[model samples]
Target: MNQERFKTLQIRLSGLSNWLITLAVIGILISIGLGWLVKGILILIVVIVITPILLILGVQWWLKRNLIQDKCPVCSQEFPAFNTTQFQCPNCGEPLKVEAGHFSRLTPPGTIDVQAVDVSVQQLED
Candidate 1:
């Protein structure tokens, strides 16, 4: 029975490792395909196609292997680990509680501040 249990455990671990590698490979493939298809799309495809898969795999592996809840305090967003102490809520600006895990690589929001050009000039006396 002990040997059987050990074999089962080994099989489970090997399966998990294989799954993670598959996810990483798929993400890379999708990213490359997107880049080739869209010349100017930038990193949008990565965010849309790859992040969710990685996040899911990370969260699952972390939760199962480590007997702790690695989740964001605010918005209840779940992560693999809480490396960062502070995180801006993805849904809102409210700060979330982070454990000792690294925060997701979030892209900063883009903004445009337009300045008006002044047409008036000072006249000089001749």
Candidate 2:
């Protein structure tokens, strides 16, 4: 999935996870109020063990999916997002520059256009 969809999924998952924890808390409270001691303990155990695991796994996948992976036009080889800000390519040592993208409200909905701008003449050596 694309980035925006992935972000939306993360948000949704966050909300769902929060809602689940809240429900578990409510269930525990209700069970205790009704004197269902065994039911309350079981619900507490499941919540304490399961909810955090699901949240951690979801966050891990979200982060992995967001890492930038692209082939360099110069070398025709792939590099990880960790090197995006470096001035030169890891393989060919060709000069590179990193720039952040900006959003335009004028653009169409549900799309982002990544355009390269010429900043090669900066005083900083390539």
Candidate 3:
């Protein structure tokens, strides 16, 4: 998956998870209002128990799907990365950008270049 698609998917997943949690909370509140205290507690327990497991599994699946094994363009150091588009090279510490599953060194900003000139000064004796 490309970076843009991956980012969209990530945002969608975040929204979905938020909706699911909201729904769970509403359900628990409704159960408590109906005097089903035990049921509400049970639902809370289930959510607490299952949410982390589901999140872990989901992240694992995402990693497996988007993991890329490639070499850093500047240092040729091979490493694995998710399809996040930009990251630092572990071995070379160079900022790397990814496109089409290929890595390249990220260039500094254009404004970084500054003109330099030698200065000369004459001092008179005090």
Candidate 4:
């Protein structure tokens, strides 16, 4: 899941970087080479608007991908899961939950295969 999200974010960032680079080149040409003040200002506005948004999204993707953890929706703190169960936020002591659903990719094999045990007894003239 994280891998898929990371890959998607990476592709988006790559495409945004390419566009930013192209716009930057154009801004440079307009500002310094041609001295087109209005066009340069417009391009500068676009740069200022998009750079921080892209940076924030990139950071979010990196944290989600590399941290290998989940963020608590209650306290907004990050935590790890031991099994398919609920937990609390360590930092804020808030009640939180972590449900990975059925057949998660992170779940280990044979974890859910076991069922109730069976017992048998034989008696003779008891």
Task: Say which candidate scores most in lDDT.
Answer: 3
Worst 10 residues of 2 by lDDT: 98-107
Give the higher-lDDT candidate: 1 or 4. 4
Q: Write the per-residue lDDT of candidate 1 for residues 1-126, one digit (tens) a residue.
A: 689999989989997998999778767867878545353444676678999999999989876654434444434565443444455655545554444443333434684535689899999999
lDDT (CA) per prediction: 0.61, 0.65, 0.83, 0.66
1-126 in candidate 2: lDDT tens per residue? Answer: 599999988988997998899788767878778547657777899999999999999988876765556665566667665323444567876655433421112224686657789876757776
- Pick by TM-score: 1 or 3, better one: 3
Q: Which structure among the candidates has the greatest TM-score?
A: 3
Report clash pairs, candidate 4: none
TM-score of 3: 0.45
- The TM-score between candidate 4 and the true structure equals 0.30
TM-score of 1: 0.22
TM-score of 2: 0.33
- State the displacement of the C-alpha of residue 44, model 2, in Å, after optimal TM-score superposition: 2.3
Q: Tell me how many residue pairs clash in candidate 2.
A: 0
